[model samples]
Target chain A: MERELKLMKGNEAIAEAAIRAGADSYFGYPITPQSEIMEYLMAQKPHERTGMVVLQAESETASINMVYGAAACGKKSMTSSSSPGVSLMQEGLSYIAGAELPCLVVNVQRGGPGLGTIQPSQADYFQTVKGGGHGDYKLITLAPSSVQEMADFVKIAFDLAFKYRNPAMILSDGAIGQMMEKVYLDPQVPRMKEEELPSWGTQGKKKGQDHKIITSLELESEKQEKVNLRIQAKYRQLEEEEVRFEAISCDDAEYIFVAYGTSARICQKAVDMARERGYKVGLFRPITLYPYPFKQLNKLADQVKGMLSVEMSAGQMVEDVRLAVNGKVKVEHFGRLGGIIHSPDEVFNALLNKIIGG
Target chain B: MDIKDIIKEENLVYKRTNVLTENIMHYCPGCGHGTVHRIIAEVIEEMGIQEETIGVAPVGCAVLAYNYFNVDMQQAAHGRAPAVATGIKRVFPEKFVFSYQGDGDLAAIGTAETIHACNRGENITMIFINNGIYGMTGGQMAPTTLEGMKSSTSPYGRDVEMMGYPLKMTELIANLPGTYYVTRQSVHTPGNVRKTKKAIRMAFENQKLKKGVSFVEVVSNCNSGWKMNPVQANKWMVDNMFPFYPLGDIKVPQDK
Candidate 1:
C-alpha cells in the first residue's frame, strides 16, 4: 500500500520532480508564479555532485539558449516561465525543435498579449499546441490539472522528449502552478541506457566509429522533405498512441464541459455545482493538448446535446472541439484573457444559459 | 623546393603528429579566418587541451571549423554559439569550452546572446572575429564595419548619416562586471598572430581557473570583402580599422 504524501504546491512539485527525474541542468529567468521553480532548484542544485548546474539567466532568451546548449551535450535540461517569458523563448524553442534536441520547457502560463498580469490564465493554448514560433514544427505538449499530475508529468515530459528527440512542454497556468495539494515523490527513475538512445548524442566520438554529426540542416530539397515526412509520421504516431483525457458523468447527461489545464479544474467545480442543482452535466478534460483526446470527445458527442468549451483564452481549443464534434453536437466557447481566470460560477451559469435552457 | 611544397610537407608531418592539417583553407585567398584558425589550433595544441576541449562553431564561415579542429565540436544555430557554449560549460564545468564566431554571426545577429552570455559570467571562452564585413555572405556590411567602409549592402561607403559606426565589442564587454578578462587583439601579422595566441591561451587559462567569462576580439581582415589583396587588406586594417578599434587588454581580473 502506498502512503499518503505531504501537501505541496504544483510549482514545488514540478521542481522536485525534475530533480527526481535526473535533470542535470536548469536555466531560467525569474517570472511570476513559476519563479518558485528556479528558486527551489537553485537552493537544492548546489548540493548534488553528479553534475547539476542551475543558472539564473539575464533574460528568457538566454535561459532557453542555455538549455539549448546543455541539451546539445546530451544532458537532460529544463526551464520554466510564465507567458511573457515563454514568448521570449520562442526563437530558441524553434531552434531546439529544428535541431531535434531533447529538453523540457514548462510554461506556467499567465494572461498575455503584452506584459499581462501575473495571474493564472490558459490563454496560451493555441500558442503552445499550434507551434507558436516561426516554423512548421510541433512541441509535445502535456496539460496537467492536479498537483500529483504536476509531479508525475515532469518525468513523463522528459521521457517523451528523449523518446521523440524533440522539445516537450508542460502547459499549466498560474493557478495550477501555485495551487497546493498532496504529492508523493516516486523513487527516482533511472535514465535510459546509452544503447537505447540515438548514438548521435555528444557522449564523445567512439574509437572506430566515425564522428556523428547532429544537425537539422538539409541543403538538398529531397533530404529536407524526407526529414519533414519523418517528423509528420512521428506526430501521427503521437496522435494515435498518446492521446489522454478524463471523462466524468457522461452516460446519462445531455450536456458536457470540455476544458484543459486550470480551466478543467474550474469546469469540474461547475460540473459538481450543476449536478447539485439536478442538472445532468458531464466534464471532459484533455490531458494531452497536442495529441488531443478527440476520440473521447467524439464518443461523448453521441450522448450529449451540446458541448461547452471553456478556457482562459478566447476560444483557441474550441476549434479542436468543433473538429472533434464535427457537427454531431452543438459546440460553443467561453473564455477570459489577460490574467483573468474564469470563476466556477461563471462557467456553471454559462452552461446553464447556453446548453441547459437559453 | 618552393614555399608551397615545404608547407605541404610540413602539413603532412603535422597530420601525423599535430592532429591539424596545413590544407589550404576553403576561405578566400586572403581571408583572415585561416589565420585565426591557425592561431587557435596552435594555442589549443600548446595548452595540451585537445582531448578535453569542446568547440562551438557558428553559422558563418567558421561553421565548418568543426571539420578542421581535431577536438570535439558542436554546431549552433545562427548567432547562438555562445549560448550553446555556455550550456556545455555549465554542465561540464571541468571541460574546456570555447566559441569561434564571425562578424555577422556574433557582432550583428547574435549581439544579444553574446552580451548576455558575457554579462552572466558564464565560465567560457569566446573568440570574436571582427572582419568589419560579412565575408561569407559576399561583402555585406557588418556591425563592426567602419562608418565609411563600403560593402555590398552599404554600397555608398557606410555613410555616417545612415549606417552607424563600427561597434567596439571588447570595450563594451569589458564594462560588464561579470567578465573576468576582455582583450582586443589582431591576426594581420606574424607578431599579431603570436599576440593572439597568447590572448586565447589567457582566456582558456581563465576558464581553467573558473575565473568567469573571458573574451578576445580579433581585429581581422576580409580581403575578399574589401576587394583588396592580402597585403593591402592587412595594411588597410592597420591604417583604417586599428585607430578606431585599438588592441589591448581592457580588463583582467585582479583575483586571477
Candidate 2:
C-alpha cells in the first residue's frame, strides 16, 4: 500500500514504471532524448531489485531483435530509442508484429527527415500510427502529453499489448522526455513465474509439453492471408474497445484544438488563452494514436465550427483529424518544424488566424 | 530373412532421433543442411536435453527449420538469429539455446549481429553452414564465396578486386575474446560428418559451462547452386573450399 511520489524526468519515470510493472527484460541502445530510460534502469540495477534484465544492445537493430526473442518467449520485454534508431528498428518491428508477439517499444521523438535535431518533434506520427514498418500491422500507440502519463502509459501500453498479443509503442517527444514533473510511482508487481508463462511462447518444453514454434513466415498465401485477417480483426476490436482521449472544456465549445504529446500541452494553454478572450475554444487530446479517437472527433465536428490540428511537425496528425471530421467541419493544421516548440500565444493566434480570422 | 524379422528392434543398429519430427525437410537432395540437422537432433537426443532446448532458425533455406526441430523454436529475420539467441539465453540461462545459420545469413547482412553476439560471449551455440554461395536464393554470390568462385551473381567468377575476399568467419570470430570454442568441419565424407557431429556436441556442452559463444562452422557443398552434380560439387568442395576454409579447430578452451 506504499505509493511513492517523486519528481522525475519522463524518461526516468518510464524506466521505473516498467520495473514496477514486472517487465522481464529491457534491451536497448543509447540514443539522444531517451538515453535516460536505459541509464535509469542500469543505475537502478533492476536485476537486483525486480529481477528485470537490462541489456545495452550494440544498436537499435540488435535491441529490437532481442525484444523479439524475449517476447517470443512470452516475456514482458521493452526497448527505447530516438528517431533514427527507431528507423533502424523497422524491420525487427515488422517481424515482431507479423509473429504476433507482445512487447513495448518507446520512441522519444526528435526532429528528423534524417537526424534533423535532438529537440522534440511529432514527425513520426505517420510512422508510428500508420504501420511504420511494412505490411498491414498497427501498433497500439500511446501518446503521453505529461511526465505522469509518461510513467503511467508504460504499464498501460504493456497491458494492452499483452491483451491483444501484439506490439505496442509509447510515442513521446524530447520535451516530455527531458522535462521533470511529479509522478506517482506504482508499487512493484511480481514478475511472472515460469509456470505462468504463456503456452504459445517459444520457451523450452517440459515433459509432456508440446513444442511451440514462433514465426512470421508462412509460404502459403492462403494461410498468410488468414493470419493477416486475424491481425486485422484484433485491430478492429482495439478500435471498438480501446479508444482513449481527454476532452478539456469541449462541452460547449465552437472551436477545438486537436493535438497530442507536447503539442497537446501547448494546445491546452492555447485553449485557456482563447477562452479567456471569450472565443469558446477547447482542447481535444487523443491518448491512443493508433486506435484514434475518430468517432468522438467526428461527433464533436457536428458541434464545433472548426478545429486546429497543432503539432511539432509539418502537419502530420492533421490528416487524421481531417479524416475524422470528413468535411463535417473545417479542420486546419498549424505547427512549427525542426524542433521548434510553439508558444501558447502562437497556437492561439494560429487558431484565430487559420480557423477563425481567415 | 523375412522383412519384418530384419526390421526388428533387436536387429536395429541405428534409429532416427526423436528430436527430429516426422515432417519432410525442404532442403535439396544431397544438401548439407539435412546432414547437419540430423547431427544436431542426434546430439540433443544423446545429451537428453530435447525437452530443455530452444533453437533459432535463420532466414535462408532453413527458415522452415522449425517444422523439423521437435523442440521449441523461433524463426528469426535474416542475420538476426544471434541477437535472438542472445535474448533467449539471457532469459533462460539454464536452457540450451542455439542458432542455425547459413553463410549469407551469418556473414553478410547479419554480420553485425553475428560479430557482436560472439564478442559478447553470449553463452549460446552457433551452428554455421558455410556453403560458399546463397543457395536458397538461387546461387547468388555470398560473403563466403571464394575468390574467382562462380555463382549466379558472380557468373564471370568473383573478382577479388570487385567482390572482395571470402570471409573466414570461424577464424575471425575465434580471435574475439568472447568465443570459448571455434572449429571448422565439413560433412562431405562419413569420417568428416562424425567429426562435425563431435564438434557440434562439444559446442553444446560448452554452453553448460556458461562460456561465451561456441561456434561450429560446417564447410558444406551446394551442388544445385554450383551448377554441378552432387558428386562433382563434393569433389569441388574438397579440392577448393577446404584449402581456403580448412578443416580444423580455430580455437578451443584453455585449461583453467
Candidate 3:
C-alpha cells in the first residue's frame, strides 16, 4: 500500500531520489536554489558506499566533464544546477547526447539571460525541450509539478536515459526546488539490475574480443547523416510510445488551460478557483516535453473554444500548442519572466479576458 | 617448444612481415614518433597487454597513432585525451589505460584536466611527449617551446618579454601531492631511449599496482618544425631544451 506524504522541496527530492536510484557519482558546482542537492549528496552520499564518487568540481565545466567521464564508464551519474550553470553545461550536454551516454542532469531553473535572479522561472522551456546546445539533438525533459512528481521523475529520468542512451533533464524552477514538503525515501517499485543494462557499457570487453569504442565523431557526411536519421527515428518511436500527460476535466469545457512544470501547479489552482466561480475551465499538463502529448491536445482542440498557454517564459511552448491545435482552437499565451512566477489570479484573469469577456 | 623458442619464432616472423609494415607513416622520416611507436609496441608485447590495453591518441601528431598501434585506440578531441581516458579508465578500471599526448595537447588546452587528474590521483599512466613546437599544425609555437624559439606563430622568436617562457609540465605536476611518480626523460639517443623505455615500463607497473597518477614526460624533437635534419634537431634539443626542462624523476613516493 502507498501512503500520502506531507511535503518536500523539489531539489531535495531529486537528490534523495538519485541516491535511492543507485547513482554512483554526483559531480557538480553549486548554484543558487540548487545548492541543497550538492549539500544533501555530500552529507548522505559517503555513508552509502556503493562506490559513490561525489566531487565538487572547480567549475561547472569541470563538473560536467567529470560526469561525462564517469558516465562513459557506465556508472550512474548526475549533476544539478540553476539556469546559469545549466547554460555553462550545454556544451558537455551536447557531447553526452551525441555519444549516446546515459546520465541525468537536473535544472532547478532560476531567471536567466545572465545571472537574472534566483527567483522561480520557466524561461528555459524552449531551451530544455528544444536543443540547448548546437547541432540537431533533443533531451528527454521531465517537467514535475510537485515534490512527489519530482521524486518520481528522478527514477523516470534515469530509466529513460538508459532506454534512449541519452541524457535526461529534470526541468524545475526555484519555487518547486526550494519549497518544503515531505516525501517517501524509498521507491515502491523494483529497480533494474546491472546485468539488465545495455551490453555496450565499457565494463571490460569480452574475453578474446576487440575492445569497444565509444565516440561521437563521424567525419564522413553520409555517415553522420545516417546517424542523425537513426536518432530521428528513435525520437519518432518515442513520440509514438512514450508521450505522457494529465487531463483535468476537459470534456465539454469551453476554455482549456495548458501548462507544465511550475506553471501547471499555478494553473491547477486557477482551474479550481475558476470551477468554483462557475466558469467552464479545465487543465492539461504535459509530463514529457520532448515526446509531447500532441495527440491528446489535438483531441481537446476539437472540443475547446480557446487554449491558454500559461508559462513563465514570454511565449516558448505556445508555439507547440499552436501546432497541436492546428487552427481548431484559438491559442493564447500568458507568462512572466526573469524569475517572477504567476499567481492563480493572474492566469484566471487572462482566461477571463480571452474566453469569458470575449 | 619452450616459451623462449616460441617468442623467437614469433619475433622472426614479425621482423619479416607485420600488419604495420605497409602503412605509409605520415610522420617525417626519423621522427621520434616512429621510435616511440616501436618502443610502445615492444612494451605491449613484453607485458602481454596489447589485447587488454586501451590507448587514447591525442589531437596532435599522434592523433593517428591509432593507425600504427595494433591495439584498440580512440582519438580524442584536441587536448581532450585526459578527459576521454578518464572516462575509459573509470568504466574499465581493470584495463591497462594510457594516454599519448603532445605538449600542445597536454599543457595548452588540456592543462586543467591534466592537473586535476594528477591532483585527484587517478590510477592511470600518461605518456606526455614535449616536442617544444606544434608539429601537426605547421610548426606553431607550443606551450613547451623554449624561450626565443621561433616558429610560425612566434615569427620574431618567442620573446620572454612578450610571450612567456616554455612550461615545464613535469616540474609543475610534481608539486601536486597526488602525483605518485613524475619523471622527465628524453628519447634523443640510444642511452636516453633505454631510459625512456625503463620509465615507460615503470609507469605501466605503477598502474598495475594501482598506485595513483604515474606521469612520464618525454622531451622529444620536432625535426620538421625546427627545420633541422633529425640529427640536428636531436642535438638542438639536447643543447637548448634540456637545461630548461631537466631530465630526472621529480617525485616518487618512498612507499612505492
| Best model number under lDDT | 2
What local lDDT does model 3 show for residue A112?
78
Q: Which DockQ-derived CAPRI band holds candidate 3? A: acceptable
List candidate 2 segments past 4 Å from native. none
A14-75: candidate 2 lDDT, tens digit per residue: 99999999999999999999999999999999989988999998899999999999999999
Q: What is the TM-score of each predicted model, taking all chains together?
A: 0.91, 0.99, 0.88
Model 2 clashing-pair count: 0
- Kindly report which residue stretches of model 1 are placed more than 4 angstroms away from their true locations once superposed: A1-4, A49-51, A189-198, B1-26, B45-48, B229-231, B248-256
Instruction: For model 1, state the Cα shift of residue A25 in Å.
Output: 0.9
DockQ of 1: 0.47
Which candidate, 1 or 3, would have the higher DockQ against the true structure? 1
* Residue pairs clashing, model 3: A7-A181, A7-A182, A8-A181, A8-A182, A73-B91
State which candidate has the highest DockQ: 2
lDDT of 3: 0.81
Model 2 RMSD in Å is: 0.8
Model 3: per-residue Cα lDDT over A130-219, one tens digit each: 898878888988888888888888889988888888899999889989988777666433333456546665444455655555556666
Q: Candidate 1 residues A326-356, lDDT tens each? A: 9998899988877788899999988978777
